[model samples]
Target: MIRTGTEYRDSIRDGREVYVNGEKVRDVATHPMFKPLVDIRARIHDMAHDPATRDVMTVTQNGQTNAIGNALPYTQADWWAKRRATDTVLDAVGGIVTRVGDETVGEMWSLLDGAEALAAIDPQFAPNIKAHIAKVLQADPFHVSANTDPKGDRSKAPQDQDPDMLLHVVKETDAGIIVRGAKYETAAAYANQAFTKPTIANWGDAALSDYAVGFICDLGAPGLKFICRTGFATRAQAEDYPLSNRFDEVDTLVIFDNVLIPWENVLFYRHTQAAMHIRATLHRYSAFAFVQRSLKLADMLIGAALFNVRQTGLDKLQPVQEKLAQLAVWRESLNAHLTAAIVLGERSPAGLMMPNQSLLYAGRVLACGQLHEMMHIARDLCGGQISLTPDAASFRHPDTAPWLEKYYTINDEWGAEDRRKLLAFARDLLNSDYAGHRLSFQMFAQSPPFAHLSAVYRNFDWDGPLSLVKDAAGLSDRVLGAKTLTPGDSSLSKWFATETPKGKAAK
Candidate 1:
């Protein structure tokens, strides 16, 4: 079921209408704006078959192999494998690229978690979700999510404003439903399909609404247009903006113009409760992969800052070391949250393993909430030189080459060329337009800052802390109008079973 790199490339060449920077792209796999990310995605598929990486990139069950990222997580070890596979891909790519398959395939698993509720509301549509979940594993298509969570002008409803502002079911047919509206997606131009769904909105107790619809949208289907923001790849020399050229995941405003979602692909329709259920828990598993990117970003910060200080001998300064320590602290804080979430994992409503919700959400908050400040610290440690440095062309020019070489070369180990490349990298990672875009992307990629805080509020085990304080203060249960809360969190009870071998921790 696993696809080859070439197969992945051929799949996206299917005559999908794609435009970027006012030009219609004929081949996304080769277009300058998209080729880098497309090639990186292809490398991920190829890694699944490459002997050295296959063990980490794929899993086998019932004598069939599937991508590790596509397998449904059932145990802590499975999560570890998924984490490892994602890290392997990031390491291979040398820069962060969000919206690749691993980070998004989990959105389908969230639907699986809501299957019971979805079935209760609409029995006819529940089976479609389970089938698509299975299809993800067997077919191994590069999947992504489609939802900007567009908060339209609060004063006007969809009906008052443009009805097409929010993607809605225009009409249903014997074959399928035709959808109209648009979504901001990062990789729709090259991705195989998207788990299309409703953005966040007030359902207002409606039993049936046109806006309550979700589907498996074929990206190559008719009447779809991908209009992307201008890319950073060809704007400058790669040597001067390595990360930009190699890692820009082109975001697109995907216009779904009467696109058909075959009857079989419609996961839910005209069911507000089902839509609300999905909106509540959309990022349950996907957030782990999303936050993992911040962990890698932290690593990049530490490496870039540490190297910059070291090459300049500024590492000797106690003040400089403290700044580095702060970066390390933030980095390890992210690592600790991610690690603990896996070890303290919980079971989903569907009996699938979920990373400990509290720790995962908390990690997401920490990662996205303060990434800007961390980037600033890195920017400071990298020094003004990152911004003031001469371009690669200036360094290569005969007229200015001698001056840059004399000024940039620090030691025998740090040559003029190496110094120039390092400064360019630090600049791209911390100061370029792409840098700011990535910062904003992470902050709002999963949801807005308020949404991240809302998730933390919902997932944190408040009862455990409340019970601890109540016992300490000798408070009466009657005052709270509820039964006495237990000290142990019900979610973690299984993770913390009392029964165990001598001197061993419960799992």
Candidate 2:
């Protein structure tokens, strides 16, 4: 079932502890710093009920209506529908938002894929995951992800340093497990829940440990505290920093001070093998939504840069055309990977449709690894005026209005006020404080660059290339003993072997 925007706003008014900029937020929905994202999230909820977009945003299955984002993907069409729903949300919000429910909800699906392995350790884990997945559809809560603990003193173990440095089960009560520590989570100040899990680390050879725990954290739980980073929305005037004022998704360090995670919420506990499984495949499905953000970001970069150059008549230059082509190449590369992944979607052990791992991970590497460079190219195309432009107030001031107008106006087609607005937009999109922060956010949003490469290594078809080289070298049959090597069977063949519904591209 879908909720109205008002219901979502009221849900976060649970009086949970939330602080930012040395001030405690009395109401996240009304706070200036948090209101921007809260409002966008609310609008997203409303979008599902709007007649214009309701069809794209909701799906009916088994005679029950649910948010498309919460529906489990089973067919190739299901993935396409998911992609379309996310696009509809982004289009309505007018910017990229990475941590909304659609992206983080998939983490549970990944765990669903590993249910058998997790159930081996604890019989209750599998059913718990399925139940929570159902709850996501039924309750329509705003979900987020929680990883990346404070993890102080890497050189020392949790026992050697502060035990609370990494989130661990402090004790187990009859009702639930009490956990203490903190996690760096984006949008936790207002989001409903988070899939709290272990970060990627060296989990030494141990049968069981308190640190290897994963659960669904209710953000409004009694002992929870949200210590948030300063949001950009209130940092400056909205007129000059449009993107920052509207699209800044405030991040927070959520302190779990003996917070209670109910037993039913526990996805895995005291199982290092399950923790390892989670780390290995955490982004298996979620990365589709994450990388989709970069594609929109690419469009933003291209649109901002193209508009700037076209205004100044630089679009006529061949050099300018080459730079624009470079941006398009990056944009299309992401599109290709996302499209190919759906066309060759594979069926998971849980019977859900998964994007082709090799293509999806490879696309993630391209989208994240080269984001800053693309931003830089866009910044270069916007030219130095983006940095030197005066504040919007100067153009409106009576003392300087005439002077600014005379110099800023290029022709009748490009008026002074229009020029001022474009430069201000370019500044925020490329040179502002928010731009820098978002660049860093994109780079490590999923994990690190090294981890991206590791995923590609694990998923890429090495055997195809290996067999090609061995055959070219005239290797004997005994060399590959007992293993049949198809010399040039493409990776697509293996992915298509899975019994998933054929995507339109495949048919």
Worst 10 residues of 2 by lDDT: 498-507
- Model 2, 310-378: lDDT tens digits are 987999999999999999999999999999898887789899899999999999999988888999999
Query: Which lDDT tens digits does candidate 1 get at residues 1-507?
Result: 899989999999999999999899999999999999999989999999999999999999778899999999988889989989989899988989888888888889999999988888889988898899989999899999987735477576666677788899888899999999999998899999999888877656678889889999999999999999999999999999999999999999999899999999999998888888887899999999998989999999999999999998999999999999999999999999998888777789999899888899989999998899999999999999999998899998999999999999999999999999999999999999999999999988998889888998998877777776777788888755766785564555634575332212234
Model 2 stretches astray by more than 4 angstroms: 493-507
Q: What TM-score do all the candidates reach, one by one?
A: 0.97, 0.97
How does candidate 1 score on lDDT?
A: 0.89
RMSD of 1: 1.9
Q: Which pairs of residues collide in candidate 2?
A: none
Can you give the lDDT of residue 372 in candidate 2?
Answer: 87
lDDT for each of the candidates? 0.89, 0.89
Please give the range of 10 consecutive residues that has the lowest summed lDDT in model 1. Answer: 498-507
What TM-score does prediction 1 earn? 0.97
Error of 1 at 75 (Å): 0.7
